[model samples]
Target: MRFTWAQRLTIAAAIAVAPMSAAHAWNESGHRIVARIAWDELTRPQQVFASELLVRHPRFAEDFAARMPPDIAARAADDPERQRWVFMHAAIWPDLLKAEGKRLSERIAALPAGAEKTELERRLADVKRYDNATWHYDNKPILIDPYALPPAAPPGAKPIGVQQALPNALRELDDRNLPAERRAVALAWVLHLLGDSHQPLHAVSLFSARHLPQGDLGGNVFFVVKPRPADPTPVRLHAVWDDMLGTDPKLEAATKRQIVAAFPRSRLKQELAEPADPPAVEAMVNLWLDESYRAADTSVYDANLRAALLAPLPAGATSALPVALDRRYLPAALPVARRRAALAGYRLADCIRRAESRSRP
Candidate 1:
């Protein structure tokens, strides 16, 4: 059913980003770029404060230091380069928790009961507390069939999603009464989810009577194939958009410098949200989600792609054949993704500066 909110954002638009244990919102590289953009804009005081919070995070050694490159970890704790490296790590930390949790579970399952399994369980429990799949996308559903019944869930049993969690993360970070550790957890979430809010699919999902009765799970279920030279199996539509900027997992200094230079902050402008209260906080976050929804409606799902997705596959056909995008899709959609990532960085900076500029670690 149609959402009643002014921007039509319901509690949850599509399924969890990718079963909660996997983060498909943005590639690790993309999230790093977003974080770098914000780090560049922060004043020295803010940078120190932000970096201090990351240090206070409960998993600092396990999640941050252990995974950090030796060259970076060798720098002084407050070294600007080291801080920049951690900022990128913090932005994708939530996703890392999920990946680690999944790995822990697999290792535990494979091992016979022993000390190793017990330790893994403990780690998994810690990871589980932070691995929330829905936090990645607070989607607003869009109807593919104009007359289809509106999505079923609503006021009844609300879906836990970024729509609610993101604001809470802000409030947690801003609440000086809380311990630094709690705020540190909030810091990682803010870094990751702000970029997620800008992803078009994370903001909107398609619903239809026959084809997508339960929504496209924010494009996770919507498959398409790119024109590859060889074997090209259908890939999740969500994935194609996630890697629009670039997919190399490494966050090299040179590449980071290149992306920050390429996007150049010119086409990105979003209202900076300085949330004063809970409701106000929601409104602020919704502004980003709404902008993303507009992009998804106006651009990503062109008429041809929509037609194929809104109808069921013919007898035994596949999305590879029917939903293949024309070569123009990437060239056209890439800029939109890039601009949004850049804007996410800008908003993330504005968000931190407005929310924590006055607070001291």
Candidate 2:
């Protein structure tokens, strides 16, 4: 059966499930697909080493193993697919920590004065320490859209962003001198942060003459709606792209392969060079940021989206009326997202393999 362009756009947006509270991109499905792709690139021995680090994570049993869906849990302990699922789970652990922290808060709230509440409070404190909220994105301001725009106020101090944290995460994974426990934590972070680094919105904030003079806060304030939903509720453009790969809650093996195969390194030859010895850590991260910034300039802030966003705001509101994404936006945007995600996966695999900690089989 044939579908209209509008229908196709709606289909594209509908893949997103409920929006996450975090404005970061590459929602759970995206991160998991990146991890899946990286996992497939690893040899069996490498996979074993990575999986062992995940096992050593402080919350591995509580947050990972116990949370496995029944289908995965039913597999034999040595099943390769099940182990792959662990990698997928590890990739989303940071976001999962957010929800877990929220649950702990609510559970503590409901509990009366007792040892149980005290222990829960301690666990919540631990979650607070473990969560690094600022590391997901680094906004490079786009000061000029079509017309000259006023400069955004200088941020007094540099905000810690993924660009800074990612290299540290890599250093952590590669620093074999660190205890296994610390390496385990870094492994989870690297799995998640690399995928975030590739998202275009995560790399930029648009400063335009009209409604977004202060910048669009990395598209968090860039409101959009699905073409057909005609639903008036405004959704963040950042959240829309977060689910670009699709949003099934669980990552089955078949689904994983489909997403990985959709965007391979061959498709990104122009966007990225063949893997080489990574330069200094900071330089490597800057290269990733450059790819995302370029993606944001062409694909994200394209003519259609800019026109919609720059139009007048609602009479009494700060944001423009939510712009309906047309067929044109998704066509260019989805491919960029897929290509970046696939490259992230491939590059992440390279990082794991070359890390000083990688042991021979």
TM-score leader: 1
Off by over 4 Å in 2: 1-22, 110-112, 144-157, 229-232, 249-262, 267-277, 311-319, 356-361
Error of 2 at 195 (Å): 0.3
Q: How accurate is candidate 1 locally (lDDT)?
A: 0.76
Clashing residue pairs, backbone N/CA/C < 3 A, model 2: none
The Cα local distance difference test for each model comes to 0.76, 0.78
lDDT of 1 at 282: 86
Judged by lDDT against the true structure, how good is candidate 2?
Answer: 0.78
Q: Over the stretch 107-206, how does candidate 1's per-residue lDDT look in tens digits? A: 9999999999899898889889878877888667888777655565656766678888899998898888889999999989999999898889888777
What is candidate 2's CA lDDT for residue 159?
Answer: 61
Error of 2 at 4 (Å): 26
Scored against the true structure, residue 198 in model 1 reaches a CA lDDT of 88
* Candidate 2 lDDT tens digits, 79-168: 888888898888999988888898999999999999999999999998887787878888888865576364645679766779999999
**Where does candidate 1 stray beyond 4 Å?**
1-23, 154-156, 228-231, 249-279, 310-322
Candidate 2 TM-score, true structure as reference: 0.84
